[model samples]
Target: MNSQSPQTVLSGLRPTGRVHLGNYFGAVRNWVRLQEKYRCLYFVADWHALTSDYADPSKIRQATFDAVADWIAAGLDPKRSTIFLQSEVKEHAELHLLLSMITPIPWLERVPSFKDQQQELKDRDLNTFGFLGYPLLQTADVIIYRAHFVPVGEDQASHLELSREIVRRFNNFYGNVFPEPQPLFTETPKVPGLDGRKMSKSYGNTIPLTASADEIRALVMTMFTDPNRIRRQDPGNPDICNLFQFHKLFSDDATIARVDRECRTAQIGCVDDKKLLAEIMVENLRQIRARREEIDRDPSIVWDALREGNRIARQHASETLELVRKAMKIDFPELR
Candidate 1:
């Protein structure tokens, strides 16, 4: 890939299960907008999931399918973006092994997520080689496609920086082969869960993107509103209300204005506000729900998409591996 060409952005999500409102607002929504300007490669990171959930691998297959369906339904056009599965491309493992040789143990140890996850999953034994080497695998995932940009949130900035340092080290010894990938910081929205915590599947507070209108209504109806406003006539704070935060995103200018005015003046009760927000959310996500259902019906079609993506991904990866072999003096002309 030419350095002067349009920047290439690579991002992948682990398919634990269904994508939720946080997933949409925090990442996928930005991804949709990014595709318009940059070359995008989005993949299902099933291999990464194995690092933590190796105990039960059966669920991964279904999770990947669900994740991919959500991706397509969220407006990741197959015609523009290369949507693929990580494990399907064999070269990633190869590149990970090669990169592993050069990466220092200290670098892996310092990754914030490593310790954070270890504490989070204390019941599971995470003291394994795969856990430490996941960052190297991530490095390979990006450079294999020669991606120059990675769309990431603030929490992930360190990973991109580490990948860039690795690229620099490799280039110093083997010549300039891979361009250091830059982090494209995406400003994620504050989409809270029903309990006002960060929306996550583990928390069981997420409103899934695939949620039905009735399900959405039910979830919103149960959401926490302003606690200070004890009475219906008490002046409410929209800023403190999770339902009002959602309205800011899904509701129109007129509706938002109405909510802001009514809430401050104690005209609109929390019940009425929540019901209105639920209706807005259901209407907003209705198209994505319909599209996801349609795509999920045909299993073969999903596989076909994955196969095609694998074909496209392997072409670039193979070329990079061949170059790496040459640089490391592994390829002998006479032997070939």
Candidate 2:
């Protein structure tokens, strides 16, 4: 696609901690593929991180750097896609403020995550205005870029629906200055953690993307498998095995079929099966780990790319804000 007419795709991730296997298969891999066909903008959502992690804001900066490094290691090229930090572009806050004025409290309250997160994170005092209005800020994140599509998994469809509704409401009041961004649904496979649950950092069950070969093996050895397989001679169920789910992603078809048959017939043990998976996972991530090492040697690589991308993002965001001001009849010549 050419620079002038490529379809724009925008997405971001909260800078909570190091990326894990779930993140690579669920989002970053798809992003890498999208960059080849579209104009992609990926950002570290540091400000969004503050919505939930405001109690301790000290980690946001370092987390942003680490997240960007993982993105690059996972094959997101800065030359092909704009990589940035959300807080660096002040226009996002401005747009979020403007959007919040038109967005009703009831609308934000109806979001599924609003109630879900409040209950899930009962320790945090989530009654604050910032927590309530983050969805509006998320709307700003998308429409500020005037993105044609927002890549999302099925569970996030409701969040993007709110963004679309805000775009419609804004256009109804002002002129049509923003496009209603559409969802590009992604088929992300389920990546279970070592504990046989959905892989998440909060669960403390993640296998980080930058883990060493020994670490990978150690972590894989902890993965939960079929509970019925009590003895080495006992028949195992690959269908219910968490390790088998991982095998589907990293192992070849031949290996997968062999493992399935062997496990069922008592020809192989979980220890041997897990060891093979660990080896395959380490080899699969060989190049990514090497690139991560290069970035670690010089942390400036991530910062420099984000700096240039912030410049590009700011330019686009400034133009969008100007149009918004004009549409709302707030752009007075005397102010300039």
* Clash number by candidate, in order: 0, 0
Q: Give the top-scoring candidate (lDDT).
A: 2
Alpha-carbon runs more than 4 Å astray in model 2: 1-4
lDDT of 1 at 140: 94
lDDT of 1 by residue, 62-83 (tens): 9998888888888988788888
Q: CA lDDT of each candidate? A: 0.88, 0.92
What is the Cα-based lDDT of residue 310 in candidate 1? 83
Local accuracy of candidate 2 as per-residue lDDT tens digits, 230-286 = 999998999999989999999999999999999999999999999999999999999
Shift in Å, residue 132, candidate 2: 0.7
In model 2, the number of clashes is 0
The alpha-carbon deviation from the true structure for residue 291 of candidate 1, after best TM-score superposition, in angstroms, is 0.8
